[model samples]
Target: MTETRRSEIPPTTDPRPDQQSPAASFPSADGLRFRPLAAADVEAWLELVVRIAAFEKAPWHAQRSELEAAFSDAVNPVAENSVAGVDADGGLRAFGRVVKNPGGDKAYVLGGVDPAWQRHGVGSAVLAWQEARAAERFAADGQPGARARNYVEEDNPALRALLAGAGYSVVRYFSEMLRPLVDVTAVPVPAGISIVPWTAELSEAVRLAHNEAFADHWGSEPRTAEQWAVQMTHEHLRLDLSTVAIDEAGGDVAGYQLATVDPDVEARHGRREGYTELLGVRRAWRGRGIAPAILTDAMVRFAAAGLDHAALDVDTENPSGALGLYERMGYRAQRRSMAWDKPL
Candidate 1:
């Protein structure tokens, strides 16, 4: 079967026993096989991840090197879990990951399946493997089952249905919203606040600022400079687009906003897309309208980049009513992702 022909792919779901059995042929003759991926599968995995994201119209831009960095980190997590699904051909076909929630013991993560392999047990298989891995880890260390969870944008019924059938239930939802650059005007920083270019010299400050801002947000975790460095290695990174708000008086990172654009992605997405990857204000700086101020700065940066819109994601259950804050800034929900979890 050709890569584009999914008609021969397995059924929408397959319940693999808790353990694998010996079979020369696939359990179901749909020409699908499930196995773990190795370092050699990096390039294939990258292609599949991009294809799957495009299929769902999700926003992401990553190169091969970025995938490698992420996979390397997977073996050693800064704060997340991951899994992969390989076919009989020994090629990667699907992937999923769960991030450790700093606020709780759960993993809130994201996943995707190759379109051509949809309903072929690729996504289901990947998730099942992830669950088993978690289970084994617990068995070895004697820790409680770390509940594995994720979210699906409400509009993605296909993904929602698949996950639900696999024993994952929606526990929370969030919207990914965007604001037109034209609707924003750059405003001067308030007293005690200043904007500066994010650079290697200021890496420590940037890390501290983000850690502080996300401290109380959902899925909070202890992030170190190493984690930040791994993220920086992402092929999609553009330091110029990432900006930080500094408190010159205290010489501390009070607030920050990181943004990036990809020409390759622009070609695929039609219009250039910019991400509000990270936006945060220190606890002490909260309620001072600092987040909005930093947002305005981000809009200014986006507009200057000749982009028309900028996007950011938020958990609907944030303690600070962050969704309301985004709405006040003119962001409307573009997509709602749902989360599903099963005992590991």
Candidate 2:
């Protein structure tokens, strides 16, 4: 999905303390010039994301605070991050950003162009420049391979065409599924199934379990305890809104469903949505209905908190057939977004 304020979970820049992304082509284009984005560009950049999402028929709920957080070291022009464009008539008409590249002998592309400003040699120039920058950065560190790779949604014909025409091919596919809070309940816990809140005392355990669950995910990255603390301790967080399923006797995280109600989301969507952002069941715990059970708990909690709905994304073709699960629970298809990439 396109990076929205709600889905700003950026790819990890470096998986470990010793890893890094490569610099690229920075290959100069004919007319379009490359430049780093300024702080003032944050507002405009976010607006662009919203407009593009709408253009794709998936309008996301983003907040001003989230936008401001985007232009920082975490999201800005680090070796792993990029912002490039040209000023026509003293104003920006085109823009694109590249996320962290998976550093190796091969290179990766975590970037995209505004559809409205496509063609006219703009995208090519920008991409060429990125390749140059990637190569340059790698040279500074004296590394090899670092080839660039990117993933495109199978259903996004437009992006598929653009990347293919530009030398990119579909490599992998994922599904976006949802879980409706319809007929939610605090179902009776099976003998070993225990509901646990991510309280201050359980933070470390919860974080460890989350990391383990996502370890096999494509492009997974390691996160430090401090980083987990930073997010869980957000000033606006409502701890009561989250639930982590545990194996009480085994002391392991089996399934989890973290919920949130962004003020911006509620205001924009005109409904109190108890958004289920992260819902997962460990690989070994699958098929026992652990995931649906956690989701149901979230929906019921949200309903009790005055929420109108609960939503989440699942890879369309997940072995789990997550889409069928949500559909059975009353969640509807809302929108879709795509990604495009080419090797350097």
Candidate 3:
């Protein structure tokens, strides 16, 4: 993700009928109304998301369950941290949300205008609401050096220009890498380590290991137990295809490769693809080839499960040299995305 700087801004309250509307700032919005999204809007939200995904050719789209989970997130409740734009008929036209990280140093801005509503000033209004809300969150938390961040696909020049105009700058680049699940090779597990299938009992241990493993990575924060629990039970997670490496002597998690399969993606792409959602090895076990071993094991299992490809995203400047490692393992960058940040 690219980082950008932001100037101080006034805080805004949640957009409700009785309060100042986010769309009111954009006179050209043509009577669009704004308010916090509620549970009843889930289906409409998914429809809007799918439309945006197709228009942008995004790598993935949100599933209904994912949206439900987001609404239930304790740190970023949908009804409080989200804004949705609707027309006279109450159809969702645009949406935005600010999600504060557990570490309180970053608030992720996510949302987009529907393809049908582009260029009518809706995008700008949505972004304005998101930035103001993110700033409000930062002020409330009293965190030093906090910033608002957004990710945009490299192919999306319109959004990139909008972010730039809003004072956001690209701070980092990420690649979505893909490798065919053919002729997968097995890498030897490190000595004194055992590759085991992911289990319900090992979920917490792996989550703890993951937090430590990524502590030094850019923009990463430890996942709270609640957040980890949500991820562990996500509808797309494929337990049978995931693997965790255990230290034989300590009986602790050394590393893990969590895999997932998005049925929607498979249907749209016409190929079953396995996504390596999270892969990490604890710092103490870094140089023992544990990462590669578990990754190889996951790939082999994916192929055995009849998957056509394996994919994962990696930060281009990862502290752990992850980009080079994935390259060596036969993955190629399919596309790039930028992370933009604005200081709060």
Candidate 4:
């Protein structure tokens, strides 16, 4: 089937077990067959993800609903750019997709492999496929200096070696920080600024503030309206636990913290943790303590909602000095994910 037509069919919620297998319908290398991913492959894709996460001792963050939505996103077109590897039993072993950035300046190469399949050529083959696809997409857009980026957990030796062998180099590091909510103190808002609960009406303003705030950040780009809306209305979003700081004098957004609660995490860990998905202070508001104040407000709100902890991810080299601020605010780095880039 053609790439554009592959994702036309709706996904199957319940993919059949591998025990009842179907004959290979695609090409093979190293005894593994490959095919373009379809919307119907979401279930199998998730199964492979769960297996990989279990072996890695981490929780899988992408939900089934999110993957399904992504497969159906007309703009992103992940299903069109993705490929999956299947083992002899017709079970999914690895999957990868290269997604072009909003402005078509770059593309993100994201993928996962079943633990048993790692180091067995599955990852290498998928990486090659993703890079080729990334180059094709970038060339189509006439983007120059096209770079393919991917993130791997800091401790994954096999995957790290695979990427390094493929000429990918470490370009960035991201830390996952966690802070206990017990006895947390909320900072008083600075004079002439107010912290207000986030509302749908403020999404666009907040999006603009986010773009402006992160403009100087490395590898950052202004999000398109569709990307911003998807993030704000994401399934895991907890609007009540989120807050935005407003400049009382001009009534414009000064800073904001958007939070989310993962039901899968709560169910698995028996504890709730509020995630600060986006936290930013506009350029004019920086150095005035707006970011910290809004973050403190988010922590207080999370605590009030009975959440035991709050979490956020930060780039180690953030131009805004966010790492030190988070540390001083009682957050500790729990783990890290490292970004790798390969020029195509």
Best by TM-score: 3
lDDT of each: 0.61, 0.57, 0.78, 0.73
Candidate 4: which pairs clash? none
Per-residue CA lDDT of candidate 2, range 1-344, in tens? 11122332433323334434544444344555666656676676667666655555443433455444435434223434465565554345445455443333434444445556656666666666566655654554477644445455455565566567777655444444444455565545656888777577776776676667666654444444544544564434567978888887878888776666666555566666766656667777777777767767777777788877776665554455666777776777665434334445
Per-residue lDDT of 147 in model 1: 75
Candidate 2, after superposition: displacement of residue 178 in Å? 4.1
- Candidate 1 residue pairs in clash (backbone atoms < 3 Å): 102-219, 102-220, 150-339, 151-338, 151-339, 152-337, 152-338, 153-336, 153-337, 154-336
224: Cα error in model 2, Å: 3.7
In terms of TM-score, how similar is model 1 to the real structure?
Answer: 0.80
Task: Estimate, for each residue in 1-344, the C-alpha lDDT of model 4 and write its tens digit.
Answer: 00000011122122212211112223245867787778878898888877887787664446566567566455446545677887789888888776665345567777888887666777777787777777766666667787888777888787789889999999888888888887687687899999998998998898788778877777676666665655655678899998889999999999888888877767767778998888888888878888888888888888889888888888888877899999999999988878888888
Off by over 4 Å in 4: 1-28, 266-271
Pairwise lDDT winner, candidates 2 and 3: 3
Top candidate, metric lDDT = 3
Cα lDDT tens digits for candidate 3, 1-344:
11111100112222223221222232226768888888999999999999999998877766676677776665566766788889999999988887775445778888889998898888888887777777666665666676888888899988999999999999988888889888678899889999999999999888788778877778776666666766666678899999889999989898888888887767677778898888888888888998888888988898888888998888898878888998998999988888899986
Query: In what order do the candidates fall by lDDT, top score first?
Result: 3, 4, 1, 2
Of candidate 1, the 10-residue stretch with the lowest lDDT total is: 1-10
RMSD (Cα, Å) for all candidates, in order, is 8.5, 4.9, 5.5, 7.9
